[model samples]
Target chain A: MTDTYFVAVDWGTSGFRLWVIGRDGTVLDSTTAPLGMSRLKRNDFDRVLEESLDKLGIAQDVPAIICGMAGAAQGWCEAPYLCAPTRLDALGEGAVSVRGATRNVHILPGVKQMAPANVMRGEETQIAGLLHAEPSFAGTVCLPGTHTKWVQVKDGAIQHFETCMTGEQFAFFSQTSVLSHSMILDGWSDNAFRSAVRLATQDPVAVPRRLFSIRADMLVRDQDSATARATLSGLLIGQELMSVVHYWRDQSVTLIGAPPLCEIYLMALDVLGVGGRSLDVETTTLAGLAAAFHIQTGTVHA
Target chain B: MTDTYFVAVDWGTSGFRLWVIGRDGTVLDSTTAPLGMSRLKRNDFDRVLEESLDKLGIAQDVPAIICGMAGAAQGWCEAPYLCAPTRLDALGEGAVSVRGATRNVHILPGVKQMAPANVMRGEETQIAGLLHAEPSFAGTVCLPGTHTKWVQVKDGAIQHFETCMTGEQFAFFSQTSVLSHSMILDGWSDNAFRSAVRLATQDPVAVPRRLFSIRADMLVRDQDSATARATLSGLLIGQELMSVVHYWRDQSVTLIGAPPLCEIYLMALDVLGVGGRSLDVETTTLAGLAAAFHIQTGTVHA
Candidate 1:
């Protein structure tokens, strides 16, 4: 059994994940919690961190590297944002060390694009892991989530990126808005999804006006809740696709998110006659954290 | 003093307005309440109506004529939608009488379109009022609200229309979404609103992608809460404007809504280099109710 080298943590907005790295620079053990910075204070973070360490029987002296909203100003401490056109190979260089934590915790900085005004935290670490796997890869990387990110990479650097509130809007429309009464959480319709995606892709401007159709169709045509749910998903993703046509058109594309979410995005892209590959978010997140550890410490993993 | 004839009620989703029509066919006395169909049960509506009639010391024998969300299926009683290509001068033809009410309460039916699957409740009454004022009015009638309605009128009938959830989106963005922390309820930034509206009109597809900028601009440029709020408003209205360009472009436009809301739409139209006329909503609702009263009862007001 090797000594723990460090702990890699992905402390996101609504959840937390931790991994103990052995001296061989591999994950020895891991744990996750529903701890997020949005509702908890710095003291809560400390308590959670201690509990997580105890869960893995890791010693107090082992350092930790964290990413995501844990770095937000409203989070544990302000890690601040690294401006865009940023290089991917050395994201850990911008890590901000938590001053009064239980251990030496360094929070990775997020990235910001100024003109169109966009920002992201944890996604930067994933991009770093991506560069580690394909250093020369140059294309569009789409990471779909509540706030989906579209990153343009060239020559190991992030050229530009944009964030769309597609997932959040979907949740709002289907859960809180007038469409809520007509939506079914457990139902789906692929054909409905594909048709909506195609309509939205072709006439993106009509989306705002078209949203009420779900309610109207439910009243008049008795549109299925499953079909309504799929339409909602399709319209959001399709509208997002229209904004990023320039990024994805005639370019190699990769999607990094939960499989189900990525599957939906992939299906949306298929509607546009575009193709892309999907990467598991957790795997890339861990790889990105490991890559950061190696890149910053001048250490190589087996 | 003329004898009371009937009560004209504009019962909306969130508020209520009423006018007592005299035997001479003009407003005799009036009162309003915060009554709305969205929150109250059908029995609650009966109680409110009775109370409202008592407020003005009107007799139980006096009938009531109602419009707006009171006609929704979830309303007092189902005032089933009157399908479109609906005639503007005779909307009362589709009125559904409230069977068990204290008096002869008639809830005017809303209008529905099949192919695009759109529906409107209260706005049709406003349109009827517009036709009363301008009997041969042709072109777009824009009624801005939580769900702003764009109605096309020609040959004394509603040819087509669409609904945009602009105001609702603004509410969500400024009060419920990530931009909530950065928004000020009493803020005003006309320049920011104009700029955002123009951008959205030109590229509506980018609205969803650009929403995060309110948060980003607040983070990076320290964008003003007023500016952030106005930008949010601009983006939503701009996106809606893109969808209705064909309706407002190269046409006579009349905006019928609350003065403040209509002012915003007028400004947006100005940004598009288009001109429109705004009507006070309360006045129009009264005129609409009166028009329905006259058209149905064949009585003329002096």
Candidate 2:
């Protein structure tokens, strides 16, 4: 009962995850619910938070630190974006307090890039986590998702970043476009993925053309569904790499996301002769929230 | 009744266009039905054909010439794809006969490219139409649509051709992807479209990056949906042009498709300083069908 020191929450758009941390930064206990920000209104947020804390058997007085879409405009309480060139350590300073909650609760801020116009809700904390682990870390970070993010970090702040719709684009074409009619939804091929990435790296701008080739291969050349599916993934990721290949090709790269998706990115980077490594999102998010919790609520334990 | 020389039908995936031609290759009557190949089972095709012919008040003895998806493997009767370098004039030579029908019905063959694997069901007829108008027409033609096609025509044969799923890709991203949430479905911006096309041509592989910008622009830059929609179109078309720009850069390109779609292609082509002209798809389809009727079933009138 005394092991729990603080509560950490990663409340995303579709999923909610909470962890009870000890005084020395260990996970004492954890729980998860499908109650993401998307499922709750302003009024329901307090109830969900209280229920989550109670379900974990944590003391009501234990302060909570939250990140992700829970800080979005449509979330519990908008933690307005902290514009980029934002110091990773200073994220705690921008945390917005939940109104009328029994315990002290803070939602971390997102970062918005004004030029080229991009935004990230939960990733800023992950960036903080990276810095917490390697305060001197300097390089580019790639986060793969439906809207994949490519961020540049140097010194102690997020200097710049760009978002690519490659993942979503791949999904739409594979599942909803005319190409869907010619594909086997469950089949895949690694060779096809590698070959496509190589082709995309060579002609970068021609990925869209190769997309039609996927359909044509089935219609004319007897290419199987396995090859088609992999080729689709490779073409999209390859196209994305081309935009930043010049910058990332010569630098050390860190990919932080789910391992399966990150592996594909690493494989693609290898095709371009670029080097990179990955960190799991769960570790980073927890580290990030803990950092913010300590900075903003240092007296909670005292 | 005397003006009815032969019946010509353009049966597509979702559209059925029929034209009744005169002895001198003028349209005597025409009709269209919503019953395209996609909406019917194989057994329903002959009935649709009979009903369509009867609806047009044409005698069964008049005979009928058909093109497009009606010749697809899934359509009425499979008129197998005529592998490429097959003479466009020989499209009629490859037509397959339908058995036990009241009239002598023939379905024209589509063109298929083996390497890079591509096939076209209806555009070959449009190419035949181009040759009928200018038998010596030698250059490239761009037909933009759900599956936009680029063909290299020389000496009345489709020397080589490539299909770009650009239109469909744009539609999916604009309407189905995460970007759709930030866009205005009905608004448009010419400048936005032109600039997007120009930028895409400048950095062909980066269109996916620009897609995220459309959403970010709305969220962070206060950009309107009008610009967002046009940029989406331009980015896709621009990427498509990048694939064929070198071969097409110095040639006299012809844009053949529905006027609205062709205009977008022509506008995109102009951005690259590539000089090209357009031909109405309807005009070309009719001319091609009449030529096929005269060559494949000349005895119908005799």
Candidate 3:
């Protein structure tokens, strides 16, 4: 039997990315589509997968591993969540197989925190990747995005985590709320952002009032649009920090997300007098998916 | 010259209500329209008012006193906000006249707080009405609505106030957010609401996390949608209370709004162990507009 390579896919709600990896885990090719899980039907996932493989000039027999919303109940195949306190490498074991596919396909399950009732899909794969990179990593991992996750990993296992809808709330408020009038789509104010963070940290309960005050400031104080945008971002991020700072305040914190957002989190952390380092979410997710793929095919230790 | 009754209009952002009040302050007739400030262009306000008067068979010669968004800069006439630390009765003094109108039309000015930069249009009229009803009322006035106003009244004057976008945020989040899927629009759970209130009051910063947990709870525990809706409401109101409970905690609080929403605020205040009494917003606005009308015509004391 000839052993060649496989594809790793991070199929999120609003995005899709596929990477063809060499037998030794080198990325041979990659492609992405805006056709995310939300935009695809159940059968459409298989069709899209085949089309993506064809575009990449990959054979139908090549195996593939998937992560994120693709594993959700509404996705291609429902990959039931693996309850927490579970080892990161064990993600592959909870993966559900995509039956009737010409190629070998599996979807990784998400992590679920039952007590507080929080669930994370694609981020769990990123955590798995982070764990694979730093096998002995302990303390907290902050994954910032639309739904930012703060995970505690010790001894190669995720202890517990929390999710904040800070990014989504920012998107919703800036685009649809009254604050939209005062916000610029692009550009930011560092000073305003940091000042907002300090204000939120000092009196976290005043966040709701502060949010309205952003508009009032714009109207009464003639605040700039860039400052308004940054202040909004800072307020939401600050609120998130106020809630979850306890998770990383006393420990080493590593952020994983797009550089821009991670930088904001880092700045927020700095404002709170806490230290944090950032890692690329894409790299972590790819590494995590590749690690899961390796574990599934028995090429690596779990 | 004969002195006849005049019309009092509480024109808000999304609603318009007009009451014909006699010289003795009795409501002779009343009517309402969905044509609020947001729905009308500058020219449309005059036409709408004229049409509304025609529908009620009102004489064009009879003068009208307007409050709320009709007095906004974007409305028929710009009634600049009266800065705080001013008596509620003095609202009449800031009234702006509608130019080229067949009948005498005066739009009462809103109240603005400069430091924290808060503004209230129609609620000021309601506050004025509250003051008219209780001239010696010295404490907090919570006018709950799309923008809930927490006004500090002392010696019949509005000292300062803060605006919480609680109701607006609730509307936006429940209608447009991921949490929308987990929410049932109509039914509510009192238990879930109170529990969420307690959760928010105890750890106000956990609000962003608690919001996402509603979706998580629905997914993991199959929580009911009604419970999710109530919880969302409770969380927002609780956060509002956490921020401004100081205003009402040590003083008398008069709740003013439609009964349903005012009940929620009352319940929230009750959870905080603060006593409050509810007042009808319409009645308050009528009394307020009437009081302002009398003052504008120099028929009563300011």
DockQ of 1: 0.78
Per-model B-chain TM-score? 0.96, 0.96, 0.96
Task: For model 3, name the residue pairs that clash.
Answer: A129-A288
Overall local distance difference test of candidate 1 = 0.86
lDDT of 3: 0.87
After superposing candidate 2 on the true structure, give the runs of residues whose Cα lies further than 4 Å from its correct spot: A33-44, A47-62, A100-103, A299-302, B1-3, B100-102, B299-302
Model 3 per-residue lDDT tens digits across residues B122-230: 8888888888888888888898888888989898899999889898889977887878988755689888889889999988988988888999998999999889999
Off by over 4 Å in 1: none
Colliding pairs, model 2 = none
Candidate 2 on A1-302: residue-level lDDT in tens?
45678889999888889999988788888899999886889788778888888877778888889999888878888899989888987888888898888888999999999987889988889889989999999889999988888999988999999998777777787887777876855787788899999988888866666788888888887778788888989988888898876458788689899898999999988887788999989899898998888788654412
Model 1 TM-score?
0.96
Taken in order, the candidates have interface RMSDs of 0.9, 1.2, 0.9
Q: List, residue by residue over A190-224, the lDDT tens digit for candidate 3.
A: 99999999998888888888888888887778888
Q: lDDT by residue for model 1 over A1-302, one digit each (tens)?
A: 88889999999988998999887867899998998998798778888988989988989999888889998988998887888898976577778878889888888889998887888999988887787777897899999888999999888888899899888899899998888878855599999999999999989999988999898999889888999999989988899889878899987579999899999988888877789999878778887888776666666743
| Local accuracy of candidate 1 as per-residue lDDT tens digits, B163-210 | 988788788878888889888555889999999998898888888788
Instruction: DockQ each candidate and list the results.
Output: 0.78, 0.74, 0.78
**TM-scores (chain A) of the candidates:** 0.96, 0.95, 0.96
Interface RMSD, prediction 3: 0.9
